[model samples]
Each structure stands twice: as C-alpha cells, then as structure tokens.
Target: MTAEKALLGCMMKENHLIGDTIIKAGHLADPRHQALFKQMRDRHQQGGTIDLVTLSTTVDLEPFGGISYLHDLQSFANVEKFAEYEELVLEKWKEREKRNILTVAKEEDWEIQKVIHALDQINEAKIDDHIAISTGLADLYEAPWQEENQIKGISTGMLRLDQMTNGFQDGELTVVAARPSMGKTDVMLHFAKQAGWNGDLPIIFSLEMPNKSLIQRLVASTGAINRLKLRNPYQHLTEAQKEQWPELIGRVSETNIQIFDGAGQTVAQMRAKVRKLMHEYPDKKPLVLIDYLTLIRPEHHYGGNAHMQVTEISKQLKGMAKEMNCPVLLLAQLNRAVEQRQNKRPMMSDIRESGSVEQDADVMIFLYRDAYYDQDADPKHLELIISKNRNGPIGTVFANYNQFTGGIRDAHD
Candidate 1:
C-alpha cells in the first residue's frame, strides 16, 4: 500500500467517514490552487467578498484538471464539505487553545443539548431562538460610553481636517472638491503624506496621473517643491531650488507611502484592487484617493443617467469606506457654474452635477486658487474652503502653495 494510505489507515477511526486521497499531484501544482489559497487568506483578513473575477488570475479550468477529474476529486480533496471542515478546524483550534475558558456559548449549547437528551425537555427551553440569544450576549461586553465615543473613525491626517472631522471616524465618508487646475489632488496628497507618518499608507487610485507622476508629486510635496517645478526644475528654478530636489526625494522615502497603478480602473475593478492592497497592508487602513469621483465606471447602467450614475458611484464608494473601515478621500470637480456665479468660490451646491456627492460625504472641502482667476496675484496662497463640515466647525484655512514643490504649508495666521 502507498505510504499515504498506510498513514490514513492508522489515523482513520471506525466511525469516521474517511474518503480515499485522490492526489491529483499535477493539478495541485496548477496556479489555481495557489491563487485560491492566497485569495482565501486575503478575504478572511479583510472582511469583504471576493467574486470569482475579482478573486484570482487563474480563469481557465483546463489547467486546473479535467471536468471528470474535478467532479470526483472535489469530493475526495474535502472541498465540498467546507462547513464541516470549518467546524473541524475550529475544534482543532479549541484543542490547542490553552487560554480558552469553555466559553459561555459553548456551555449554554451543551446545556441545551443535555436538556434535549430526552424528547420531553425539547419544548422546555426554546432552541429556535438560540442564535438570537447568543448574538444578543455581545451587549454584556459592550460599554455604552465607549461605544458612543468611538462613533466616527478619523483619518489620522491633519489636525485642521481632523478637528473638522474628529478625524474621519469609523463609518463616515469624506469628499474633497476643487476646480480644474485648483490643486485638489495636491491637497489629498498632503493628507496622504500625513497619514503615512501615522503608519497608515493610504492607497491612491489615480486614473488621471500615472504612478510615477504621483510618486514625483509625493516627492515634491514631501520636499515642499511644486510638482510642476520638479518636472522642469532646470527650466524654472535657481541653483538653490536645484540643490533641494535630492534632499526632498530622500525625505519622502522615509514615510510609509504606497500607491496603486490604477490607470483605467472601473468602480468594481477599483474595489477588487483596493481590497487586495488593504489585505496586503493590514496595518494601513488605506485612505483611498480617487483623483476625481466622476470618472468612475458604474457597476451597471442607470438608464443613461450621466449625473445620477456619478451620484450612485460616490454613494457606493462612501459606503465601501464605512464597511471596510477605511477613509475614502474622493476628489471632486467643481461645476463651471462656480465660474458663472458673482462669487467664484465653490459651495456645497457646486459639486458638479450630483447632489449625492455632497450628501454622501461626512466632510466636504474645496480648494480654490486666486491665480486661476487673476493674472497678477501670487499663486502661493491657496484657500482651503471647508464648504460643509457636517461633524465640526465650517470655515477656511489658508495654506502657502509652493509652486515648484506642489506642497502646501499653513500660511501666516
């Protein structure tokens, strides 16, 4: 007999339903197996669903083994009985858990089983309500004040934004808005830099900028140089600014910053990519920076709604931030309607076509530049207009914009 069969013979109990091991050694090495294991590990770590398309790279089943083989082998490999496998795994875990104090649920389960030992006691205690009773027990461990205090999950970023937010508290969504050439992305990059220092590497899904440009912008921000100047420093800068570029790149390298190459991501596709990154970087409850919210591809058609589709997308992304326990920094475009108004400054009503963008966010911040309007004024003074501070005080904060570095610093108070 094969050594595997001999091992199984000794391990198998008389009552145990032991299936013969059908080791498709070739299929075991198939990439699907490896991909499946990795996907399973990630899904368990980051509480989310992994659909087949989003779950793995191995699509074709031919390499995974034949249909006839898969049918018989799925049963033999113990794949079909996952519920049973999970129980067995948990039981094994309990056996090894030296600290496990025969939990109250376990005791209660056994108590109910003992009472059910005889048919006469079956109606005495309600077994159908057991799941509800067990789940309600969580209330015993929860503290009312503790629960109240932890209502929002703040993105551990800037004091100004955090003060406005109490930080992007758990389950709350945030949106950042600005006009074209308004440096909306610049502000979000600054926020991401701050988050990185807190050991939280926010994942940026930039469909507008390439990953390298994004890195350069970060390097510029960290260096406090205008990213535009960094790209053409020799053309625009003096010798002193030239000397600062290397030191800037070196400084940004110290932070825990990470970016995803999301050049053409649809909403569904972005979800899969972000979920993978979140799992990979478990400590960084990634702050997702979508360059602007309008470019996102919807999950499905909403009867040719150009505006409502954008609304649905924003609402879903904000919902995702809450469910995944991550802060979503959704960059938005200000409607040109701002340009037509007597006052050019953007308001809550100016978040392009969709009211949902304004409605979905816990905080809405706008970036406006005077240089965009006037020819003579300095471009350095960028205004941070807190259009809607749902949870905190609404106001403006002035920051110095380094045109060369794409960096923002709080202007003189």
Candidate 2:
C-alpha cells in the first residue's frame, strides 16, 4: 500500500507521470487508489487537467477519507523514487496474482500443466511490449561477428547444414519431419550427440521410444557399433568388440544427454521439465528435442480435433522455445501424400496437420532417403531438404547415413 500510495501521489503531483507510468488500475490493491488511478488515466486520455481540484470534482473523495487522504498521499510522494515504487507495486500484484491462481487451481482440481501455464502467462506479461528501434540496432552493432567457419547457433554436427543454418538458433523452433524409416529419430539423436559433445545440454523427450533404447542407440552411434549387435551383445559381439565395450560405454556416458521417455507428454509438462533442467545447468546451453509430434498429448478440451490439437501444441512449443531461450527440435510425421508423389521428397504440405507447424517453425527440414523407396539407390545417402529456412537459403544437404547404427556424418562427396 505504501508503494501504491507513493506511485499514485507522484503521478498526481506530476500529471505527465501518469501518462508515462506502466502501472494499471488493476495493479493497485486499494479500492480508492484503483478508482483514483482510473480517473486520472481517463482524464489524461481526454486531455483534461489532473490536479487535486479537478479530481475532487470528478470523483467522490468522501468515501476515500475525503481531501485529507489526498493530502496525506502527497506527503508520501517522492518523484526521485517513483520507478522504485512502481516496481514494488508490480511485485506485490504478482504475488497476489500467484496466490489467487494457486487457490483457484486447487479448488478447480486443475491439471499441473494448467497451473504451470497460468504461472507462465503471468511471467510473460511482465516482458516489455515495445522498445525503440535503436535498441535493436545497438544490439546488432554490439554483437561480435562470427569467426570464419564458426557456427552461430547450436551445431547439428552436419557441416553443410551448419553452414546453411549457422546451426539451429536459440529461440527457434526447428521441425524435422519425415515418413517412417526416413530416420527421424536417428537424425534427432545425431543432433543430440552434437549438442552434448559441444558441452551444451541435450534434452530429449522421447514419446515414441524408451530411454533404454535411446541410450543403446546413442552408444551404438558413438561407438560405431552395429545397433543390431547391441540387441544381443553376447551372440553378436566379436572378441575385440567385447574388449572395447567398457570404454565405449564410458565414452558415451560422458555426454550430458538427459532423455525423458514418457509417452503422451503435454507441451506444458515438457516445458516444466526443460525449465527445471535449465535451472539445474545454468552454465550449459539447452537443446530441447521431442520425437514425433503426434504422440504429444494435447489439452483435454481439444477432444478429438487433431488439427486444433496440433495447432495448439505447435504454438506452445514455439512459445516455449522463445521463453526458455533454446532451440526446440520437434520431429513430426509426414502424411502419406509424399508416397503418392512421383518424387518422394517431402514438401511442407506433407506434414500431417501441418498448417500451424509450418507456420510456427523457424526451420522445416524434411528427411529423404531414396533407398527407402528404391532399393537400387545408394543406401548410405540421405538428403536433408531444408524446405523452410527463415533466416537463410533453402536447399538440400546430403549426409552419409548409417541405418545399422543410426549414425550420420558429412557426405563423402
């Protein structure tokens, strides 16, 4: 209340301050303050005087302790600390809002996701809605230029793709879509491996595969071991491979890759988990990966509307990426329409329920392996068709892909 009184008093003393203030009537807890602030704002908007004399005539000050209360408020005014007072009022309002949200959530039996979402919305509201163009220009001018061959964003480990994209940027949503057997999981793992190797945290939300299976695949990819052999090591391993197993396991374990293999994860749940990891590892850059978008459980109210569910999920995922300041690599399935085409390469339209996904993504990469459809084509050749690159060129980046180990490398050519 002191802060509210101080802020309001300062604004009343200097009518121009009311126009400059970010605080709204809702931010003030006192009913009298709220009423006074609203009137002051309305008067200011109407180009009317906002002095005590004018306000006394327009507002019923009798219920608010009359003119004496306004005089007392003036005594609390300190224009030098007006900004500080504003901050205090905002902080108190946030606290009150959080308490109210929690009370409502408990009474309504709301899901944990809904509770977190509400809290996040409050946090989002605090961000500045507008800024000077010079502020952006200053940031660009002050930023150091990227050194030759240096990736500006998180590296995907594919040199060509890195060159094209400068790697996946922070606060960006990169959608990796493909038909089954086109190696969507494999490509996602490749990115995770690269991020982990670069000393960044790679967080995988694997709704399709178990954590153990992902670990095995990661180990196999890193070790250059056949993934099939890992299924039954005793029968498939050679004497030399057996001797190297411990070292292989230790090397793969060194990468700080955290995998959550829960099925039917909501975006809110994934966001909460990512935020926790970020807090835990503040020094490391985070790269969030979700395998297969359709597997994500949408909000209950969306019901059986697949399109609306996908739209909401895509929108939230993009928002989460920006909020967390990380790159989100969401793997999505391409509809069977690509199979119907003469050329099997997937267009943006090939993504199942793609309207929102295509709109939200900063980069949309479609994986195409000719061998998947034509046995005669080179099995190791995989094309990463960058159908959408918001900040760069759109083209294909060829990679050497190992189906056996789920490994990806720069093409020999």
Candidate 3:
C-alpha cells in the first residue's frame, strides 16, 4: 500500500514517467489507490490531461478523501525514485496473488478453473523485456536511413546471389530446389559456413543426412579435399591432402555452427527444439537450415497424403521463421519432371510434393549442373537459377561445383 501510494504520488508530480514503469492499476494492493491510479492512467492513455484537476473530474474523490488528500500524497513519494517504488508495488502484488493461490489450493474439492485462473494471473505479472514496437514507429521509419540498419539481410557469400536477393533477410523462408545430386545440400552448407564465419550462430536440421555425413561434407568443402578422402583419410589422402588435414580440422573446430540430425522429426518437434535454442541463446541470431522439406513430418497427420503434409509443414516452417525472427534456408528436391524435360532446368512448379513451398518462400533458388546430364559438358560451371525473388531481381548465377570436394563457389572465385 505504501509503495503504491508512493508510485501514484510520483506519477501525479511527473505524469510522463508513468510509461517507464510496468505497474498497472490492477497491481496496486489498496482498492482506493487502484481506483485513483486507474483513472489517472486512463486519462494518460487517452491523450488527455493527467493532473490532479483532470483526475478529480473523472474519479470521485469523496470517501477516499477530497482534493486535499491528493495534494498530501506527493509528500509520500519522489518522482526520481518511482522505479524503486514500482518494483516494490509489483512484488507486493505477486505476494498477494501467491497468498490467494495458496488459500484456494487448501480448499477441499477446489475448482480446477479457479486454480488455472490464479496461475494465469501469476504468469501475466511477468515483465516483458522485448522492445515495444507500438511506441517506436518514428525509429522504425528512420531505420533504413541509419547506417546500422542499412544492410539488414544476411550475406549468402555468393556475390550474385546476394545481389539477387539482398542475401537472406530475417523472418524469411528461402527454398533451394535441385534435382538428385545437383548439390542442394552443398549450396546450403556453403551458406551455413558463410554465416558461421561471420560470427553468427547457424543451425542445420539434417532430416535426410546424418551429422557425420554433413561433417564429412563440411570437411571436404572447407579443406578442398576429396569426399572419398574424408570418408577414409587413411587410404585415399595424398601427401599434400594429409598435410592439409591439420589446418582443415582447426578451421572446422573454430566455426560456430550447430547441427541437428533430426531424421523423421515433425515440424512441431522442430519448433519446440528451435524455441529452446532461442531461449538458450537470446542474444545470438540463428540461421535455420532444414536439409529437405519432404522428410519432415507434420505434428498432426493430415490423412495419408504426402503432398498435403508437406504443404502444412511448409506453411508452418515459414511461420516459425517469422516467429523466431530468423531466416530459414530450406533445401528441397525437384521432381522428375525436370529430368524428363529437354531443358532440364528446374522451375517453381518443380518443387516436389508441395507447391506451397515455392509460394511460402521469399526466395526460390534452383541448382542445375549441365555436367550432371552430359558427358562432355563443363563440370566446373554449375547454374543457380533464382526463379523467384520476392525482394530483388530474378536471374541465374553460375558457380564452379567441385564434385570431389562437394564445394561450390562463384565461378570467378
């Protein structure tokens, strides 16, 4: 009661300071103080005056004492110390609710509804630390002009791809579709390494591949060593390859990349796991890479249809990326339609099982290698088709794909 009186007094003196405290009228222990504070806060919220004159006009000041009583309240608190008083008031409110909950629990045949309501009230008292966007419109509008906010997108390490999509922006889903052995996994791994090397946390959810295989690919790609050498370095490695192993081992160890071998995992389970990671590393922004969309199971079975399940998973993954405020780099397979066609280039329509994957993606990149189908075709030049780029230009970029190392880099790199 004393703390609440002090806070209300401070607010009366400095009306603008009310916004700094998390305390609400309902949090005040005393009924009279709650009523007075509620009327003051209501006036403030409405953009009306918040002085004693305005407060008295809205809330009756009779039995609670007259206008004189309000004047005397200022002596009880100082405006400079309002935050300390706010904390004190909140603590008292929590204690009062805890006592009420305990009192209810002791009753025989206590209604579950009452207990649940009490617990909910307790939970609502927690202070939120997230910035209030409702009050930051001016800052948000000016953000693009500011140097720090100018480059908001995450870099993909490929110049043309970055230019095409401004890299992958946060709260977006980017789908990379490729036919069998066209290097979908390799492209995403290259992106993951790019983010990791830049000191951001990158997570890989490998539904189609195991962690060991992914690591082998990472080693092969980073070291420029043959994939076969990675599988059994003892036998296949040349003298130069063996000499370079120590440096490559150190490079992989230094990268801040985390992988999840989530074979057959549902989207709901992935959400729960990712949420846990977000909570664990609140400061680090994560780049989520799902190996392939088709392998992920939906939490609720949508009949026995694979396409419908994928559609649901695609939508949910897109939502999850927005909810988690991160970019989701999803790898997917192009259907056999691409193989049957003479062009052999994948389109948005070729995303296997679900067209929703293409619809949900902010950017859709397709990997195609001419060498994959032709014996005399150039193996070094792999084509990356940006079929759909929601934010930037759609075009094709070429990179050198080293099949032995499973590495892809800009052709001119």
- On lDDT, the candidate that comes out on top is 2
Clashes of each: 18, 0, 0
Q: Which candidate order results from sorting by lDDT in descending order?
A: 2, 3, 1
Per-residue lDDT for 1-413 in model 1, tens only? Answer: 12222222221221021212112111122345444434434443465443333332333446545344234333333323322333333333333331233354366555643432232221122212235666777865576556454454535345555555666655566787888888887787887777776677677888777778888888777765656665676796668877876776666775666666655456545655666566567666677778777777764454676675676687677766755667777888877789897779888888777647877887788888888899787878888888777768988877887756677766754
Looking at model 2, the pairs that clash are none
Which digits, one per residue and each the tens of the lDDT, describe model 2 over residues 1-413?
99988998898887877876657888889998988888889999999887779878888888779988888888999977776787688779889998999999999999987986686565346434577999889867845784445448999998899989989799999999999999999999999988988999999999989999999999888888899998899999899989998998887877789999999988867876776577578799999999979999975444486886787789889988886778999999989999888988899988898758989999999999999999999999999999999999999999999999988999954
Candidate 1, superposed: residue stretches over 4 Å from native? 1-157, 226-229, 232-247, 376-378
Regions of model 2 farther than 4 Å from truth: 1-128, 140-151
Quote each prediction's TM-score: 0.62, 0.69, 0.66
Q: Roughly what TM-score does model 3 have, to 2 decimal places? A: 0.66
Error of 2 at 40 (Å): 26
lDDT of 3: 0.79
Candidate No. with top TM-score: 2
Error of 2 at 241 (Å): 0.7
- Regions of model 3 farther than 4 Å from truth: 1-148
